[model samples]
Target chain A: MRIVVLAGGIGGARFLRGLKSAVPDADITVIGNTGDDIHLFGLKVCPDLDTVMYTLGGGINEDQGWGRTDESFTVKEELAAYGVGPTWFGLGDRDFATHIVRTQMLGAGYPLSAVTEALCDRWQPGVRLLPMSDDRVETHIAITEAGTGERRVIHFQEYWVRLRASVDAEAVVPVGAEQAKPAPGVLEAIAAADVIVFPPSNPVVSVGTILAVPGIREAIAAADAPVVGLSPIVGGAPVRGMADKVLAAVGVESTAAAVALHYGTELLDGWLVDTSDADAVAVVEAAGITCRAVPLMMTDPEATAEMARAALDLAEASR
Target chain B: MRIVVLAGGIGGARFLRGLKSAVPDADITVIGNTGDDIHLFGLKVCPDLDTVMYTLGGGINEDQGWGRTDESFTVKEELAAYGVGPTWFGLGDRDFATHIVRTQMLGAGYPLSAVTEALCDRWQPGVRLLPMSDDRVETHIAITEAGTGERRVIHFQEYWVRLRASVDAEAVVPVGAEQAKPAPGVLEAIAAADVIVFPPSNPVVSVGTILAVPGIREAIAAADAPVVGLSPIVGGAPVRGMADKVLAAVGVESTAAAVALHYGTELLDGWLVDTSDADAVAVVEAAGITCRAVPLMMTDPEATAEMARAALDLAEASR
Candidate 1:
């Protein structure tokens, strides 16, 4: 089966690792979100893409679920000594080189999509990793300050990292989404996919940003493929990340049913909710999308592969 | 006495350590050559300036004559894994961070002089280190291929790090020199100096590149200061580096007298040669410049300081 999985960072990377194990023969094409990309110390760091790449390439620090294993901080310390900006992001020395190479190639006139392919050439994640678009689409969060009524837009990292999502988010906007065209192979992959699975990633920022690009949602809806989404919310709380805070910014409740309804039956043919969210299945199925209750915890690769199997099973049933 | 020193990398850095010890109170400003600077992996690397900084800051690796004492290479290995470009240069993980910070600051519209000041804030080299210019001025060397008569210009790093300067140099050109301006404080430092000393640095590439800046040479000559140069060549050979090879490219002999005549008394008031070239003193003096024969070996800091003092004494005598 040709499966195209839309993903974010940690959870997505882990889930993809499982998917690879679950369906080794399945041609997987991952449409990774670049909304969290930041230019730190003159290197373009794509947090989501690297997370997926490293995790699948077996180089990720399994404990942190971000950055590479056995990474050093010599470069980071030198940068701090020079008083360089944005020292809070924790970019490890080994991690920095990846960004450097990516930024260099991008500066030399290669689109991000092409750069991703070149970077993936060595990783050989067994899945074709494609950035949602070649054009820049930064996710900005509109937040109300502690003392002010005015809502201001901040870069996703500033919102997620610097602020730690402390402020009240009014809205989340993906800047440049209006003009961003899907990457060269993105639309084709979505249209030709036999199964389109949305990993348990942040809906408001990860998969949402991918769907925000022009014509991507339309292509998926029009595809003959069975579209399935796994719930990132278990028992009304996110597996990781500040998904609830972002979901609140978009007026969506932190529940499996709410996320399914947010994506709607227009694009999704099947939905997989955690066993803890078994009660949400009826509400989601009432909206004309097939629903299943499965053990969705990705505590290990085996568990994650089982989750991946559940997603495929849901797609198969709906088909 | 105020002094301006033209410098290159390791040797220049080591010599400056002694110069500082010799004249503890003399106001010294180092005009570092930016010709050796290269943008590797999207980070601006000022190798010469860094050598000076690390050496004076007491963070230099005494054995390697470059990089930090406790440096690591996690970043470099990671970069190689990613198949990034230009892996030949000894860029340690800690060193990469310095370049990243510098490149980011440069991209943010800060002049290199100001950035150098900020970087020096931490190093506290005591001597003010200024780049030749804020603009890009790369040194390109023309080399004849062994198999073919075709000659091509390559960046200084490629010539030095990759080829180890093994090829016959046809010509050495500092690209962008015509349009490049002397970095801020460069002219002022020269003008305000009691004496200007050229440390036993590479005369052709290091010191030559500093003088190549539009107004620097003229400023030193117009200033009410004595300009003295210590020969990089001793016993008819360069103390370090292939200075003779590059000297040949510029049509100048590697002899101390030939180097003195190349600079001329038009810009220099005094010149210092080693005891081995004591006989050449009259030849250099005939050019209207005071010449001194000193034990110009900087085998240790005390000896280097003695050499620095000799240059100052010659400058005062000429005045």
Candidate 2:
């Protein structure tokens, strides 16, 4: 089976790990979300793409689910001593090599897609990892300061990683998504996929930003493959990350059914809500999508593989 | 007293440490050679300038006389694992931070001189360090492959560090020197100096490259200050490094007197030869330059400081 997965950072990476475990023989092509990509210390950092690459290649910090295991922060500490910052963004020595190589390639006139391919040459991440779009697409968050009531726009990382999404997000904008065409193989991958899975990644900035790229959503909507989504939101809250904050920015309720509806009937063919929110399955099915309630919590490898197995079954059922 | 010194890498840095010990109150300005600066992994590696900074700032690896004192090679190892390298260069994790910060600053439009000064803010290397030229002036070595008989030009670093100067250097060319202008304050530092000294650095590549910058040699020649130089060549070979190979490339003999004549009477007022080269003192003085034979071995701090003191005394006598 040829599977297509649109991934974000840790959560999406974790889900893809399960997907790989569930079907080791399957040929997976990942369309990683690059909207979270940021330029730190003049190096292009693709957080989600790296997370997936590191996670699958076994370089990942299994505990944190991102960056390299046994990573040292000597470079970071030295940089801080030099007083060159956004010291808030923690880039370890091992992780720095990835960004440095990517930045160097980009500077040498390679697009992000080519750079991603070149980097993957090292990791052999077991999947053809394609960035959502080769063109720059940064997700920015509009937030109101809690004390000052001042409205300001900041990069998604500052809001998510730095601010911890403490202030209410007024809006989430994928700045260059409207102008960005899908990276070369994205549309073809979707069209050729036996099944496409959205792996409980953030609705607004992760998977949503991937869909926002011009032609990507249209390609998926037109694709014959069943588009199965495992809800990032389970019961009344997110299983991980601050998804509820950005979900509110898009005026979507923090519920399993609501997230499925937000993706909507046109783009989605199958929706899987957690067993805790089993009632959401009927609500999602009422919206003309084939729905299932599964144990969606990716607690362990076996559990996550089961989630992957459930999604594949739903794809078959919906088809 | 205001002093100006033309410097290279390890040898120059070690001499400066002694000069600081010798003249604790002198205002010293260093004109560091940048001809050996090379772009490795897309980051500017200013080897000589960094050597001067790290050595004076108490961060140098004491054994090696370059790089950080306590450094890890995680970044370098990771880069090698990715098979993205000229792995021979060996930039440690701490040193990578310096290059990253410099590359970012330079990319943001800061001139090489300004970037050096800013970097000094962290190192507090005491002496004012300025690159020989703000413009790129890479030194290239012309060599013939022994077995293949193929003549090719390689970077100065490739010739020095990687090849260890194993092959006879056909020619040493400061590629952009003819077009390059002195960095800001370099000429002023020379002109305002009470005394100027050339450390026992690579005369062909280090001090020679600095003088190659269009106006620097002219400024030194026209300056009222007494200009003195310590011979990198002691009796018949260079004190350190492959100065002999490059000296031969320039058609100069690897001897103290020959090197003194290479910098001529117009540019040099005084010359210091090691006690072993006492006979060469007469040979150098015959060329209208005052010469002294001294214990020039920089075995330790006190010994090196005495050498610095002798050079100062010669400068005073010449003046």
Candidate 3:
């Protein structure tokens, strides 16, 4: 089977690992989210793309589910000592090489897509990883200050990594998405895909940002393959990360039925909620979408694989 | 006293330490060699400038006399793992920060001289450190390969660090130095100096490259200050490094008197040779240059400081 997955960072990477495990022979093409991509210390950092690459390539910090294993923060510390930093990002030495390589290649006139391919040449992530768009697109978050009540915008990383999403997000904007076209082979991948899956990633920033690119959403909707997704939200809470924070910025409730309705029947053919949120299945089916309730917690690889398998089964059923 | 010193890598850095100890209150301005600067992995690597900065800032790897003190090669190792390298360079994790900061600043349109000043803000090396020029100038060594006998011009770092100057150097070229103008403050520093000293650094690549910058040599020669130099060559060989290899390329014998003659009386008012090369005193003095024999070994800080004091004393005598 030829599969296409729209993914985010840690959660999306882990889901793809499970999907790869569940369908070993399937040719997977990952449309990685670049909304969270940041430039720190003048080096380009693609958090989502790297997460998927390292996870599948077996270089990931398995405990944390992102970045390289045995990573050191020597570079980060030294940069801090030099008083040059955002210092809040957990950019380890091993992770830094990727950024350096990527930045170097980008500076040399290679587009981000080509640079991603060059980097993947080392990792051999087993999936054709294409960034959603090579054009510069950054997610920014507007947050209100506690004491001053001052509204200010900052990079998504500052909101997520630095602020830990503690403050309420007033707005989440993908700064350049309207101007970006889907990367080369993205529309073709969707057109050629036998199965299109949306792993339990942040709908607002991950898969949502990918769809925000001019033709990507239209291509997927027009694709002959069934579009299936698993709920990142279970029992009115996120499986991991602060998905609720961003979802709220888009005025979406932190519930499986609400999220499914947010993607809507036009984009999603099949939607799977966790067994605990079985009530969401009927609510989602009421919206003219095929829905199922399964155990969605990625507690282990086997459990996550079972979840992936269920999504694939739902795709077949929806078709 | 206002003192100006032309410098190279490790030897220059060590000598500067002694110079600082010898005249703690002296207004010292160091004209650091930029010929040794190269782009490695697309990052600006100013090996000589970094050595001096780290040494004076108390961050140098004391044992190796270059790179960061408590350095790790995690970034280097990771870069190697990605197979993106000229893996021969000994860029440590902490040391990489300096380059990253420099490269970033340079990319953002800061001149190298300004970048150096900004970097010095953290190091506080206690001297005004300026590059010979704001423009790029890389020292390349022409050598014949062992088997193919194919002659090629490789970067100075490749010849010195990677090849260890194993093969004979056929030619030494300071690429881009011809068109380079002296960086701001370089000529002014020379003209304003009470005494000018050339520390025991590589004659060809270090001090030679600096002088190659347009108008700098002329500025030093026209300056009113007594210009004195300590020979990096001790007896008939270099005190350290493969200065002899490059010296031969320039058709200058690796002898204290020969190096002095190469600079000539036009440039030098006084010259200091190692006591072992005491016989060279007559040869250098006969060339219309004041010459002295001194213990030139930088075996320890005290010994090195004594050498610096002797050079200063010679400057006074020549005046």
Candidate 4:
């Protein structure tokens, strides 16, 4: 079976690991959101892309879920000594090499799609990894300062690393999404997919950014394959990440039913919620999307694969 | 007395250490050549400037004479895994951080001079070290391949690291030198110096490239101070580095007398030759440059300090 997955970082990477284990024979194509990509020390860092690459390549720090295992900070220290800017982000020496290669290739005129393919040549992630688009789509968050009435838009990393999401987000904008075309393989993968699954990833900033690209959401909606979304929220809170904060910016309630309704039955054929939010299933089903309750905690690969199977099963039952 | 010295890499760094020991109270300024600078993995690396900084700041590898001590290669390994360019040069994880910071600063619109100042703030290399110019002046070598009749201009790193001076250089050019201006404080340091000493560094590539800048050679010749050059070639071999091959490129013989004659007495008031080449002292003196024979081997700090003192004494005697 050909499966297409839209993913973010840690949560998505972990869930995909399980998905791979669950559907061993399925050919998976992942369209990763590059909205969180940041240029630091002249190297382009694609956080979500690297997270997925490392996780699938078996090089990820299982505990941190980001960066490589047994990483060293020698390069970071040297950069600090040189008084380089944006020292707040913890860019490990080993992690830096990935950015270096990606940046070099990008500077050499290769599109992000081609660069990702080149990086993946060595990583050999079982699934094909495609960036949402080759165009620059930066995620910017608008926040009002405590003392001032003026609002400002900050880069996603500034919001995540520096601010630590302390303030209320007025709005979250994917800057270039209006003009970004889906990478060449994105629409085709969605059109040919047997089942399309949205992992328990940040809806507003992660999967939403991927959907915002021109032609991607429309293609997924028109596909003959079943499209199912796993709610990132469980028990009225996000399982991980600051999804609730961003969801508030987009004015979406942090509830399993609300998130399912947000994606809508027009594009989504099935919606899977955590067992903790089993009561929300009736509300989603009433909204015209087939809903199922599953143990959504992706604490291990086995549990995640089961969650993946549940989404696939929900799509089959809906048909 | 204020002193300004022209420097290259390892040998120059070692000599500066001794010069510092010899005159601890003297305000010393080092004008470093940037022709050896290479952009590797999107980071600008000024080898001569770094060698001087690391040596004086007490961060240099005493045994290797370059790079940080106890350095790790995790970054390089990661870079190699990603198949980045220029894997031949030994850029350690700790060393990469320096390049990263420098590249970031350069990308942020800061001139190389200001960037050097910021880097020096952390290193605090007691002596003022300035690159010859903030402009990008890369040294290229014209070499003919054994199998091909065509000659190609290769970056200095390709010649130094990959070829290891195995090929015959048809010509050596310091690109961007024609329009390059002397770095700030370079001319002032030269004009205000009580004595000027050229360390036993590669003459053609290091000191020669520094002089290639528009106003630097003129400033040295016009200065009221006595200009002295210590021969890098002692007993018909370079103290360190591939000086002989470079000398051959410029059609200059690799000998204490030949190098001194190459500089000419019009620019140099005093010339120091190794005691091993005592016979060459008369030949250098005959050219109207004051000549002194001394044991120029920097076997240890004490011996090198004595060499510095001897050069100072010659400057005083000539004045």
Clashing pairs counted in every model: 0, 0, 0, 0
Query: Can you write out model 3's per-residue Cα lDDT over B87-191, one digit (the tens) per residue?
Result: 888899898999999998998999999999999999999999999999999999999999999999999989999999999999999999999999999999999
- Over 4 Å off, model 3: none
B103-200: candidate 2 lDDT, tens digit per residue: 99999999999999999999999999999999999999999998999999999999999999999999999999999999999989999999999999
Instruction: Write candidate 1's Cα lDDT for B148-224 as tens digits.
Output: 87788999789888988899778999999889999888888888887788888888789899889899888887988
Please report, in order, the local distance difference test score of every candidate based on alpha carbons. 0.88, 0.94, 0.94, 0.90
Model 2 Cα lDDT, one tens digit per residue, A1-319: 9999999999988998899999999999999999999999989999999999999898999998888999899999999999999988989999999999999999999999999999899899999999999999999999988889888999999998899999889999999999998999999999999999999999889999999998999989999999999999987899999999999999999999999999998989999999899999789999998998889888998899999999999999999
DockQ, candidate no. 2: 0.89
Q: DockQ for candidate 1, please give it.
A: 0.82
Scanning candidate 3 chain A in windows of ten residues, the lowest lDDT window is A64-73
Expressed as tens digits, the lDDT of each residue in A122-214 for candidate 1 is 888889999998988899998887777766888999999898888877889899988999999999999889999999999989999999998
The DockQ of predicted model 4 stands at: 0.78
| Model 4 CAPRI rating | medium
Which candidate do you rate higher for lDDT, 1 or 2? 2
Q: What is the C-alpha RMSD of each candidate to the true structure, in Å?
A: 1.8, 0.9, 1.1, 1.8
Docking class of 3: high
How much is the TM-score of the A chain of model 3? 0.99
lDDT of 3 at A105: 92
